[model samples]
Target: MTPTQIGLVGLVALFVLLALRMPVGLTMMGVGLVGFAALSGWGPALAILGREPFVIASNYELIVIPLFVLMGNFATVSGMSRDLYGAAYAWFGHWRGGLASATITACAGFAALSGSSVAAAVTMGRVALPEMRRYQYDPRLATGCIAAGGTLGILIPPSTGFVLYAILTEESIGRLFLAGVVPGLLLTALFIVAIYLQTRLYPELGPAGAPTPWRDRLRVTGQASSMIGIVVLTIGGIYAGLFTPTEAAGIGAFLAFCLAVARGRLAWSGISSLMLRSIRTTGFVFLILIGAHIFNPFMARTHIPSDLAELLVGLDLPRLAVLGIVLAAYMILGTFLEGFAMLVLTLPIVHPLILALDFDPVWFGVVMVIVLEMGLISPPVGVNVFVVKGIAEDVPMRQIFAGILPFWLAMAVGLLLLIAFPGIALFLPNTMIR
Candidate 1:
């Protein structure tokens, strides 16, 4: 059979395996290896299996993934997330829907440190949910804020989503990180507005907490300062060309470790467990990267990307129209597929079309990460929803989903604004000190 036909069959088989609950990394590797062997030979296929893992594992750029992840893990144990939530609560907790606004604010702050939606959601849920419950906030608004706000983890600077996208597209990680700054802040503001409007429309949804005294607000703000400081030093240092993304990550990790130790939270046993979790997360991400490496070459050999790129260009559609179509596909796939899975699967095809359409890679990375964040809260496979549900066991799963709708629409508005003003994503990257 033709290489293209074989590639198509392999793609179909990969999806079937994924549907059967096989791991994404394994499914991609299996399909890629077999497809390559069919089109080339067993020797070349096996050679890839031998070589790609080491190449991906040792990739210097990828070191940022684990370092940032460890920083997040350490930060979690340091009680930084709680401090951030406390600071937000001190400032915003007195407003209508204030706790929910504080949850979004805290999530955005923690997102800078965590680089993980699940971690942000789980961490903030633990810290914020009980407080919201104490104030008798509507369960829907409380759960929704946690789930939706968690998504900021992947859109803010130091984002895992942008990191992976940069690696996949061979773009500058620093540029992509900077590109996300404005859009991330924009979305955070949008979420806050969504909560405010919802509370206004339905007064019972979010009742205000007791107002904080100036001294208490200042104290909590000081408590959370180190976490925010670290984020600026790491992400800002990259933009200033003071450090590479990897070095920034290392520095962030070291600072988080020091903070945790200083806080007396880094017990020997806890440190060991945190390290192991970091290692596992690092390993999982590396496996997906390796699998994508294998699958990418196989797809290249099949000319699938080229064929699709040519087809899109030939259609002569408006550039924005083509871009919209690609994003829509991502949205649809995100409902069922995990973000990383969608990234590795679609980027090979989508990146080429993006370049062909003359879109900025960094801008597209921001846009893509936003869409992935939506998937994290989108129904059916909404990973963030489940994470929040795990925390609020008394709250039904459907309520969490329903709660997210307003925030989900908020995200959609954010996406449109980013598209309408691409500079929102590009401004920081373009004006980088470097």
Candidate 2:
């Protein structure tokens, strides 16, 4: 049989395995290994199994993953997320739907430290939901904002999603991180504005809280100021050419550890737990990379990427039209696939197609991450929606999905803006001090 046919069969098997609830990493590794052995021989396929795990494990750029995860754990234990929420609430809590706005703001801040959507959603939800409830805010608005806001974890700096994208595409992690800054902040602002507008139209959906005294505002801001500085020092240092992504992650983790210690927050048992979680998270990311490494080689041997790229270019469609079609398919796939798994599974093909279309990889990285996260909150299987529902158990699943609509729309609007004006993502990366 032809190699392309073999690749197609492998993809079908991939879906069947996934449907059977096999782990994504193992499924790809198994398919890739079998496909490669079939096309080339047992010797080379076994050699790959022996080599790729060490390669992915020892990758220097990837050390950033565990460091950032550890930083997030330390920051969580330090109560920094709560402090950030408190500070935002002190400033914006008086407006209708203000608590929801604060949740978005704080999630953006926490995303820098956590680099994870589930962490952002769960942490911010625990911190913000009770207060929103106390203020009689609409459950839909409360839950929706957290779910949507939490997705910022992937769009903001130190994003695991972006890191995986950069590695897959051989793009610069620093550039991708900077490229995300404008779009991430823009989406955060759009989410806040969407909530306020909704509240303006229906006041009872989110009632205004009493205004905070300036002193209280100053106090909470002081409480969160150190963590904010740590975020700035890490992400900003990268833009200033003073730190590599790995260096920044290391420094951030050290500072988080220091802060946790200073606050007396990390007992010996908690410290051990934190390290174990970081190691597991890092292992999870690395395992997927190893799988993608194996799978990519097998796909390359099949020549499917080159063939598909040629076929698409031959279609003579307008570049944007082709781009739209690609993104549309990604949206459908991402609705069901976990973002990172889907990202790795496709970039072997999509990156070449994107490069063929003459789109900037850095800008496309930013746009792609946004689209991936949108699917996370979109209907039928909104992962983030379910995450929020998990936190707010009293709220119906349908209500949580309904709540996500505006924030999801806000994300769509933000995606469109980034698409129309690519510089929104590219400007920071393009003009980096280095």
Candidate 3:
């Protein structure tokens, strides 16, 4: 059979395995390795299978993943997540749906540190859920907000999603991280607005709490300042060109470790256990990267990505129209596909079409990350929704999804705003210091 036919078979097999719930990295590696052997013979394919893991492992820039993840784990062990949540709640917990809004605020803050949506959801949910419950916040709204808020992890700085996107496209990770800032803030604000409007429409959903005294609020904020300071120094340093992203990640990790030690929340004896978990997560990310690298070349040989781009560009649709089609396709794929798998599988095809349409890569990267965020809360495969359910198991799954609807709509609005004003994403990146 021709290479195209083999590629087509591989695609079909990949989806079938995914349907059977095979892990994304192994599935991609298997299909790509076998498909390439079909086209280029077993010797070269076997060499790649043996060689590519070392290549991916040795990538210096990729150290950012493990370092950033370790930073998050340290922050968690330090009880910094609770401090951030407490500060946000001190400020916002009195407003109607204020508890939910505070969850978003806290999640955004933690997302800046953790860069993992699952970590944000789990960490915030553990602290905020019982409070929201005690205040009698609607289960749907309480759980929904956590699930939706956690997605900020991927759209904010130090995001693993941005790192993966940058690696796949060879774009600047710093630029992509900077690009996400304004939009991430915008989306966070929109989520707050959604909470305010929702509770306004149905006051019972989130009753107001007794307001905290100004002195207490100030005290809580002071307590949380350390977390705020660390994020600013790390992400801000990267933005100012004071250091590379890798260096920022390393600094953040050390600061987080020191904070945990100072707080007596993490024991020296537990260091090995913490390192093992971080290494495991880092290894998983590397496996995905390796799979994408192997699969990308095989897809290139099949010419599917080029053919699709040529066909789409050949149609001469308005660039916005083309972009709309691409995003719409993302929404559909996000319904069932896991976000990481969906990303590596499709970027080889979509990234070129995006460039061919003349969209700014940084801008598109930000836009794409938002789409991925939407997928995180989308039905069936909304991973963050599942995270919320695990935390609030007493809350029904449908209610969690119900709560996500408003935040999801808010996300749509944020997406539209970014598209209408590309500068929202491009401004900071464009202004980066030399």
Candidate 4:
């Protein structure tokens, strides 16, 4: 069979495995290993397996992944999320849909510290969901806000997704992290606006809660200073070249631990649990990385990415049309695939195709992230939505999905903004790095 045909068959098998609910890492590795052995002799495939593990593990850039994950886990156990949400609620509690807006704000802030969407969603769901429910906030809005807002964890700095994208595409991790800032903030703003607009159009959707006393609000603000300090020290330190991304992560983890202890939130038992969870999460991530190392080279051997690039260029389609097609594919795959799976599966092919077309890599990364963010909230297997659903199980799944529609629309708007003004993504990275 032609290499193209072989690649197609491999992809179909991969999808079939995924349909059977196999782990994504295993699916990619399984398909790639079998296909590589079929394409080349068994010797070359065996040789790849022998060498690739060391290569993947030795990659200096990859260290950032576990460091960031560890930092997030540390922040979660430290009880920082509660203080951040309290501050947000105090400031915004009086406005209609204020609790929902506050939830988004708090999620964004917590994301700055946590950088894992699942962590952010699960953490904030614990902190914010009950409060909103207590205030009789709209179930749809309350749950949707947490789900949608948690996505910011990936787009904002310290993002595990950004780190993976950087390592895969060979882009500078620092610049990609910086590029995400404006887009992340814009999406956060868009989410906030959507919440307000929803409440305005249907006041019944979010009844105003009791106003927070000014004195109490000031006190909450004081409690949030630790979070502010950590954000500045970590993100600011990275941007200013005071520390590498990994160093910043380590510093953030240390500070979070200290703060947790200072606040008396962490017991010896809690520390042990946090360490175990972080190690387990890190192990899962490393396994996926190893799988990607094995899988990516096999796809490369097929010449599929180059062929697709040539085919697209030969068609003479408008750049926008090609981009639309790519984005549409992400949306579909995202319904069933997790973000990391989507990136690993596609980047091996897509990155080369995108580079061949002469699109800016940084801009393309931002666009890809936005598309993946949509997948996080998209139905059937939206991870963030499920995280929220798990939190608010009393609320029907359909209602939560319904609540997410406007936020999805807001995300569409954010995507358009990035597409129209690539500078929104490029400007910060260019100014900071160059």
RMSD in Å for all candidates: 0.9, 0.9, 0.9, 1.4
lDDT tens digits, residue span 192-280, model 2:
99998999999998998889999999999999999989999998999999989999999999999999999999999887778898899
TM-score to true structure, per model = 0.99, 0.99, 0.99, 0.97
Compared with the true structure, model 3 gives a TM-score of: 0.99
Clash pairs detected, candidate 2: none
Model 2, position 413, has a per-residue lDDT of 89
Q: Candidate 1 lDDT, tens digit per residue, 1-434?
A: 89899989988998899999898898899999999999999999999999999899878899999999999999999999999999999999999999999999999999999999999999999989998899899999999999999999999978888888999999999999899888989999999999999999998999988999999999999999999899899988988889999999999999999999999999997878999999998888888889999999899899989899899999999999998899899899999999999999989888988998899888889999999999999979999998998999999988899999999999999999999999998888888887
How many times do residue backbones clash in model 3? Answer: 0
* Tens digits of per-residue lDDT for model 3, 1-434: 87778889999999999999998899999999999988999998999998988998898999999999999999989998889888998899889888998999999999999999999999999999999999988998999899999999999998999999999999999999999999999999999999999999999999999898999999999989999999999979988999999999999999999999999889878899999989999988998999988888899989888889999999988999999999999999998998888889999999889889889988998998899989999999899999889988888888889999999999999999999999999999899996
Candidate 4 lDDT at 147 equals 94
lDDT, model 4, position 75: 76
Cα shift from native, residue 368, model 4 (Å): 1.0
Model 1: per-residue Cα lDDT at residue 282: 85
Per-candidate clash tally: 0, 0, 0, 0
lDDT of 4 by residue, 1-434 (tens): 98778888998898788889898777877788888998997899989888877887888777777777777776776777888888988988889999998999999998888778888899999999889888888899989999999999889988888887887888888888888889999999999999999999999888887789999999998888888898889887777888888888888888887877887878887877778888887777777777887888788888998888889878999988988899999999899888888988899988977887788998898889889989999989999999988899899999999999999999999999999999999987787733
TM-score of 2: 0.99
- Deviation from native of the Cα of residue 55 in model 4, angstroms: 1.8
lDDT of 3: 0.92
Compute the lDDT of residue 247 as modeled in candidate 2: 98
